[model samples]
Target: MESDNKQPCQTALYEEEETLARLTKTANFQGASGINQQSLNFRKDQMCDSPAERILKQLHNKQLLIVNPKRRNGIILYKRYHAEFAGPGSAVGVSLDTDCQKILPVGNLDLISPESADDRQRAYLIRRQWVRLTLQITENPEPIGRAQKIIEQFEGFFDSATIAKLPDEAFSLLVGVLPHTVAKVRGKR
Candidate 1:
């Protein structure tokens, strides 16, 4: 009799775990959609009045939502969890220029560089290149083919460039930044 009762309880626990896993996956998928603020607000209204806050609370106790002061009306934005694993907004890494030699670190790249004009310019150019390339690659119907062509065309762009001229310290910094950027740019619908 006790065994029979325990069987049902175990089944219930398994079901609960499955449900939680599905919910997490759905939340991650929706979050990664990169919906604009208005769309996000609409989604929140349709789904939950405070979706981000709710998700954050679920992920971490004592978590809070904060507003973006830059906007005219402060918009409530949840603090990103693990960016790589979280949502699209919480992506990691930096953007690089056409040469694939320069880097513009995301989130905190500015803090890593010196306050020199040349350094700032280099960083800005690198970021611009990254954005340009990202747009070009994503907008293409055959991104892989296009990217290959572009890469081949600009193969030697970085040959003359030296690491000393770059604002970053390590070549791995450039390497590390690509996966997140690719994920962000290519993971979209």
Candidate 2:
């Protein structure tokens, strides 16, 4: 009886993986531009929507697509994937860089696999530091002033010993406020 159940379980797992692969592939193909009506229709067909409109409605709710209101036909001008922390066959992770590339802790959070507690602690600290930096940037209005303030606040968060021990990337991220704040600064240079 156990052996009989195993086959069905394996089949279900295989199907689920295949579906995920398809979804990921479709999502990546979209790029930053937009998907056409044909692609949207294909997705709707695959999902078995009785009408194309309903599928589009579902996609809008999921935030996978955005419709242009000015357009006559309610044209979808952009498609965005739901932010996923985990890739295929992987677990949830956190984005650490400005570009949003290079996810850390690439595996199931519950399992922890080979990552140590120290590594997890460092990631947590980085996340906290990012939140702090973001809040400081938002609260301040002047660009140069905000940048200087953020730098000072970041420095104040660490002691001389800890500052010397901090990673280059962490420092870069902490001090990377200038570029982000410049947009809000008055007058073009």
Candidate 3:
């Protein structure tokens, strides 16, 4: 009689251990439809309000879909990254801080330099609130006029800072302080 009870007890304990191990080992999950190291891919316009458990269940059952729509000529109402992984992305060697090269996910897509159509699209993704990103303006920009002109092309798409060359040692502009702060800092000089 005791042996019969022991079997169920052991099974329950085993289940508990498995759950604990999974939670402790990783912050988020990796679904079959997501990148090899992250969660399932999300579209550019899909609202992301699902609970973690629901997302995990979707991943487990392979019910997620990754959408890569054909690019439009201009920014639009809908745009997002390829996926949303709810975990500390340390596995991808992420969160690196450096001045040479920085790769931030502008909607789960990698952005090196804001020079191509794809890069522009990624910027649009951020503009549409489809994804989150952190970009570094490392290159010493050209003369103020030309550089501002270049950056202007990307205006209304994303918020970024302009590094002023006032020789005041104020090399960094506040994030999202594009036109306003730029004028103020220049006025200070």
Highest TM-score, which number? 2
Q: What is the TM-score of each candidate against the true structure?
A: 0.23, 0.25, 0.19
Residue-wise C-alpha lDDT for candidate 2, range 95-123, written one tens digit per residue: 32222322221111111221455555544
- Please give, for residues 1-189, the per-residue lDDT of candidate 3 as tens digits: 223322211221334346544643443543323333322223211223322222222224432112122211111111122122111111111221111121222221211223455644544444433223212332334334423432443343333431222222221221223444445445653
- CA RMSD of all predictions: 20.3, 17.8, 19.0
Provide the clash count, candidate 2. Answer: 0
Q: Comparing 2 and 3 by TM-score, which wins?
A: 2
TM-score of 2: 0.25
lDDT of 2: 0.34
Kindly give the stretch of ten consecutive residues in candidate 3 with the minimal lDDT sum: 70-79
Clashing pairs in 3: 42-82, 42-83, 44-79, 44-80, 81-107
Which one wins on lDDT?
Answer: 2
Clash count per candidate: 0, 0, 5
Off by over 4 Å in 2: 1-99, 102-133, 160-189
Better of 1 and 3 by lDDT: 1
